[model samples]
Target: MTRSLIVIFTAIVLDAVGIGLIFPILPSLLKDITHAANVLPTIGAMTALYALMQFIFAPVLGALSDRLGRRPVLLISLAGAAVNYLFLAFAPNLTLLFIGRAIAGLTSANISVATAYITDISPEEKRARRFGLFNAMFGLGFIIGPVLGGVLGDHWLRLPFIAAAVLNGANLLLAVFILPESRPGSRETIDLAALNPLKPLRSVLEVKSLLPIVILFFIFSATGEAYGTCWALWGSDAFHWNGLSIGLSLGAFGVCQTFAQALLPGPAVKLLGERAAILVGVAGVSVALTVMAFAGQGWMIFAIMPVFTLGGIGVPALQSLATRQVDENSQGQFQGVLASAVSLASIVAPLGFSSLYFLFREEWPGAIWLSVVAVYALAVPLVLGLRPKAAERASTSRRRGAPENSSGDASGETADLTFRHPRA
Candidate 1:
């Protein structure tokens, strides 16, 4: 609605497009580069390398944004992304491609900064709805990205990278002129210790109550990596689909996910509560995955997408709840920590899932989805064990009655950070 929000959402869309652009074509590209029959492991390794960079830098950029303001960090990351895509476009060897991917990962760490920016500007009541739209914008980008990548890749393997570079270049310009700083940098001297990527993770871990949420983020993110790592390969193996078909399937999934995320998260949370909403989503995804695992024809995959899309409703709700777990000043740092958790998962999950898929590729390519369903199952107990909003309110009340800590950190007094309940 606001110009700032529009700009932020547009940036997210472009970023997602840049990411999705390579998905449909990555396997083929790797095969071309390595001249190997099995490029699955290479794909996994490359993805893990990308995530490894994000794991190390996401918090650094997020903390920097907290210190230097969100706008400058976003601008720098966007510029880096544009440059990295260009490098990827012209990369002649596997080593160069990996270099470009690592750079892209570093730039992709801006996601933490962007989430912090949104948290900075949105009121608590509006955060869930806004996060939903945030995901929707990303979904919309995926809708465009895979299709375009598939089409362009059919013509030339390098074209998608060029297109992505141009999109990110435009995204950089948009941010330069249109996006405003949501929060100003602190005037205090920069604490070099705070820039340590592990510092935020350690700080959050010291707060024991925060651990489950972090792990939940890890599990959710890990499950998500399987899709990006295996989707195109599975499509080709299972259905004999080409780049265009793979892209179309992904685009269709994106369309369904975008609509569901944009429209469902707020209502789902309102009606079922955050915990229950998450369970519903997990259930929906599990069912869809089961069907996918046993699907006889490609048409079945399309038919099950609506059910698959229901899986997205949980994340925005979870994000809205996670925001409640910390005070305003700590939001950027906390978000950075969460992004780090996600990056860590991304690093590990792709390798694990890709290996599992490699094993299953000969006999049952569809079995990979079963592995995802198993991972999804791991989150249920964690979700059920989460502190409810009422419990968080009670914790906040208790913290209010306690003496303030000498460090002036509002969350420092308790392991569970002070929670602010949104106005009804």
Candidate 2:
């Protein structure tokens, strides 16, 4: 990896670490703040508040990056995160906590910008592997962050946020020193109307060829985030696990995920190809969530993680496919659309899943997992149907003398045709 890649990888890790660091402790902290019989709903609302902010602001920041540059947006986000975590660390009431989380969410479009940075440097063909690398760093950070949060939080619940603040601070400083601007030409004037998060999504969804994958992304995002919103709480409720145990379990989950994301996608794509690999991944996610719903024992949960980890293949493949749908100049906007999709998921799913978990704690503790299974399963047939069409497109491109092993980028003549293709 180049120095820039390494720094960005670290940035990815830092972002995940900040998030994971809070997961093990946030529930209990929220419980203290609300003093309610059921804290799950309140926690869900808090998460939703954050996600709502993300949904509103992600496209705004993403468009700004397209106009200004990725570096400034990233740096501003890092600084905002550092401040937000500090605010969360000291928050005395739920209102302040909510405010802090909203601020954090507003600035959290950094990931989308970072992804655009990746697109700026990588060829389209290698993007899946590159995205996998980003996920690997994400998983690694999740491992370290949650473990430390759970362990340290056993003593002081506030410690994890402080740690997160420190990490973000460090990341900010490192980025200041090493991070390079990745946006190509600066837009002289950005369209204020173009910054609406919903508009870009509407446009992307209108593209007939992009519809299936976009739907797949939306469903998967909703289900995936719903699971995340409840994972720590579910363990605490179902297994009566403590913060330490929750951290360890999540850390171990991260380990399994990291291994899969770092190692599996490349080989899987090379063998089964990207489309098939995505099918395998989505199908595997459905199976894993189904199994997780039925896991009566905690150890059974551990046993199921590797199977769950296979779902990691879906994202890189999906991302790689999306990259081919747009011109290189619009990569930032494309990634912003993706982040907006995820942010939209984060907005609704947290509240929905958390409500289900809290409501059915006695009747069905694993209710949220069932929802997850259903969503992933729903996307499966759609994507499976998506395969033949993608294959046909590839076949057509090859017949037209598009490079089979060509450096899939936007500069060449073939790329211009790709940019102008009716489906594109």
lDDT of 1 by residue, 269-355 (tens): 767767888899899999999999999899999999999988988889789778767766667778888999999998788779989
For residues 124-153, could you state the per-residue lDDT of candidate 2 as single tens digits?
556789888888898798778777788889
Give the best candidate by TM-score. 1
User: Each model's TM-score?
Assistant: 0.86, 0.85
Over 4 Å off, model 2? 27-41, 92-94, 154-156, 232-247, 355-368, 385-424
Each model's RMSD to truth, in Å?
5.2, 3.8
